[model samples]
Target: MSEPMLDDDALLRYSRQILLKQIDIEGQLRLSRSRVLIVGLGGLGSPVALYLAAAGVGELHLADFDTVDLSNLQRQVMHDSASIGVSKVDSAITRLAALNPQVQLVAHHQALDSDSLAAAVAAVDLVLDCSDNFSTREAVNAACVAARKPLVSGAAIRLEGQLSVFDPRNPDSPCYHCLYGHGSEAELTCSEAGVVGPLVGLVGSLQALEALKLLAGFGEPLVGRLLLIDALGSRFRELRVKRDPACGVCGHAQ
Candidate 1:
C-alpha cells in the first residue's frame, strides 16, 4: 500500500480539492509537498497568497517590505484597517494561516533585490511576480529563469488585467522578458494609473488558478500565451506569445 498521508488535519481541510478528479488524494499529497514564493502582498499577491494557502500548498514564502496602508484595503483582500502600518508579509502570513493552518508561512519583511531575489527563488518550487514595479518584475523574472522555476505573473491597472506563465522548463515557453522586454521606469503604477479594486480581485484570482494548474499539472497553463481582460469594455482576448530567439534569459536555454 502507498505510504499514508501524515497529516489528517490537512487531509480534512483539503477534502474539497482532493475530491476533484484532477486533484485526488494523490494531488493533495503533492500540494502538501510543494513550496511557492510570492514577491508581493498587494493587489495581485493578495488573492494569489490566499488561494494558494487555501489550496494547501505546503509552504508559502511572502516577500514585501511595504506596510499596509489605507489605500491597500481597496484591492488587497488579506488585510484590514487594523493591519495598516504592519509589514505586508507579516499581515499576509497571519491572514493566510488563519485561512489554512496546514500551510507554513515564511515572511520576508524586506524589499526584494538582486541578492534577496536570488536566494528566495532558489528555495521555492515556483515564483509569483505580482509587484507593481517594472524593476521588481524584471528582477523576479531573472531570478526564476536562473532557477528554472515556473513563474505566474499578473498585473492590473485601471480596468485592465493581464496574466501569463513563463515556465523555463518548457523549451518553447516564453519568459516574462520575452513578452514585456526588460524593465522600464515608464511603466505605470497604481499610484499614477489608478486600478479598480475588483479588477485586482479578478486578475489575482486568475493568477491563483494558473499557479494551481502548474502545481497539480492538471491543465494547460498560460505558458506561451497571454490572457488580457479589459473590464472597462467587458472584453477578453488571448494573444499568442513566443520565446524570443534573442531573449537573454530564456533564449539560450531554448
Candidate 2:
C-alpha cells in the first residue's frame, strides 16, 4: 500500500514526534496508517487508547463489555463523572474523538468469545490485551498467536505494574500462556487489591510506547522482555522472557 500523505496540519500536529531522529516523516506516516485493537476500556485501556489516538493511529477497535462506574474515574481517565453508567466504549469514543478527530474509532460493546476474538485479532494489525483477567489474557494471546499479530499486554495492581509484548510472528517471543500457564490461580482485580491511579497510567503509557515502536519500526520493542514497575519505590526492572517450547498455547505440539 502506498503511504498516505500527511498534510500541513498533520505535520504540524505531529511535529514534536516527527522531529525525533528515530521517527521522521516515514515513521510518522507509518503510525498514521496502522490499525490497532484494544480490548477492555478500564484503567490501562484508557491511556493506551488516548495515546494511540493522540499519536495518530489510523484506526482503533475499542472493545469493552462493561459500563463506566463512578469508581472508574479514579484511574480510567478516558471517562468522567458525567459518563458514569454509560458503556465504556461509547464514553471512550467521545474522548478519543475529541482528542484526535482524524483517527477512526470503532466500538465493540460486547465481550468477545473465542471465535469473535480470533476474528477481531485477524482484522487488526496489532492487538492490545488491556483486559483485567487471566481468562481474557489467555484468550487474547491465543487469538494473537493464531493470527500471528503482535500483542502488547499490560497490568497494574496495588502499587506495581507489568508490561510485555508477544509477537507470534517471532519464534523467540514468549506468549502470555508461556509465562503464566493455564493454572487456575485466583485473579486479582483493582477493586479487590486496591490499585494506585498513576500505576495504571505508567504501565498503559509503556504499552502505547511499545505499540508505536512496533508499528513505526523504530527503537527496540519489548518483544522478549517483561518490564516490571514498582510505583511505590519509583523503580523499574526488566527480565528476559523465553519462549516455552512445551507450552500448550503456542507450542509446536499444539
Candidate 3:
C-alpha cells in the first residue's frame, strides 16, 4: 500500500522522530494512524502523555478523574499552578494539544471502572497504564487482556520504577498479573509512600517510547521482561518474564 502523504507541517514537526531509520516515513505513517489510551494524569501519566503527543501519535485518549492540586506540580508536568482545581484530564489534554496540534485528543473526564475500562481499552490500538495504584493497574491489565490490546505499563515510587509490555499479541508473553501476581490487597500508593519526582518521568517516558515502537512496528520492546530502575543508586536491572502455565490471563493461551 502506498504510504499516507505527510503534510509540510507534519514533516517539520516529526523530523527528528522520522530521521530514525527504524521510524522512517513509513513508520511515521503508522504512528500517525495509531491510537493509544493512557489511564491516569498523575506523575507517570504526565510524561507518557507529553512524549506520545510530541511523537505524533494519531490520537491519544487521556483518562483521569482527579482534579489537579498544588502538590501535583512537582511531577505532573502537564499541569501548572493555575490548573489547580481543574479536572486532570482537561489539564493534560490542554497541555498536550499545545505541544502538538497535529494529533487528536480524546479526553475522558471520568475514573476508569470495568465497564468504562473495557470500552476505552477496546477503542485504542494500545494501552498505557500510568496510574499509581495497583487495583487500577490490575483492572487496566484485565481490560487489555480481554480486548487483546498491547499494553505498556510503568510504575514509580520512592526512587524505584519498573516498566514492561504485556502484549497478548505475543503468545508466550505474560500479562501484568502473571508477573505481579494480581497485586496484594496491601498495595501502596505514591501519595502514602512518597515518590521522587524524576522517577515518574524516567519510567513514563520509556512507556511512551515502547508504545510508539509497538504502534509503529519497530524496535525491540520490553515484552517478556521487566526493567527495574533504582535511581537512588543509579542502577538498572531487568528480569525475564514468562507466562505462567497454570495462571490466569495469558497463561492458558500461552
Candidate 4:
C-alpha cells in the first residue's frame, strides 16, 4: 500500500529533517506512517516521548500505570507542576498534544497484565522498554520475542546507564534476557540507589535517537550493540552483544 501522504503543513513542520540526505522526504514519510509503543513514562520515557512526538512519529502508545509524583518533575520533562498527582499518561498526553497534535497519542494507564502486554507489543511496529524494573523489562522482552518485534531497551541508575536494541527480526540480535540473564530482584532501583536526574535524561535521549533511526529508516539502530555511559566521568563506550543460542526467551531461529 502507498504511504500516507504529507500535507503542506507537515512539509513545512518537518522541512529541516526533510532536507537531510539520510532522512529525506521518504524517511520523514516513513516516520509519519510508523507506530510505536513506549512502556514507561518516567525519566527515560520523558525524552523518548517528547522527541518522537516532535519528530512526527505517526502514533505513540504510552503505557504507565503510576501517577505523577513531585519528585518526577526533576527529570520527567513531560510532566510539570500542574501534572503532579495525575496519571502519567494523562500528563504526557497534555504535553505531547501541545507539542504535536498531528501525532496520535494512545493511553494505557492501567497496569498491563500478561494478555494486555502481549497485545500491546503485537500492535506496535516497535517497542521501547523504558520501564525501571527488571520484571517489566523481562515481560516486554518476552512479548516482543513472541511477536517478532524489535525492542529498544535502556536503563539508568545512579551515575551509570546502558542502552541496546534487540530485534527479534534479526536472528543475530540478542534479546534483553540474553545479556542480563535471569536478573535478581536484588537490582537496586533509582529511588533506592539515588540516580542523578540527567543520567536518565541522557540515556532516554539516546533511546529516542535509536527509535527515530528505526522509524525514519535512517542510520543504524543499536542492534546487537550495548552502549555504556559513565556520567560521572563523562565517558561513552560501545560493546558488541552476541546472541545466545541457548537463551530461554528467544532460543529458536526464525
How well does candidate 2 score on lDDT at residue 38?
99
Per-model C-alpha lDDT, please? 0.89, 0.92, 0.89, 0.92
RMSD of each: 1.7, 1.3, 1.3, 1.1
- Give lDDT tens digits, candidate 3, residues 1-100: 9767899999998999889999999999998999999999899899999999999999999999999999889988889998999999988878988899
Native-structure RMSD, model 2? 1.3
What stretches of model 2 exceed 4 Å from their correct place?
Answer: none
* Number of the predicted model whose lDDT against the real structure is largest: 4
Q: Which stretches of candidate 1 lie over 4 Å from their true place?
A: 1-6
lDDT of 1 by residue, 74-175 (tens): 889999999999988888988987898778998898887799889999999999998998888888998898889999999999889899999999889999
Per-residue CA lDDT of candidate 2, range 229-248, in tens?
A: 99989999999999999988
> Residue 92 of candidate 4: its Cα lDDT?
95
Q: Model 1: how far is 6 from its true place, Å?
A: 5.3
TM-score of 4: 0.98
How many clashing pairs in candidate 1? 0
lDDT of 1: 0.89
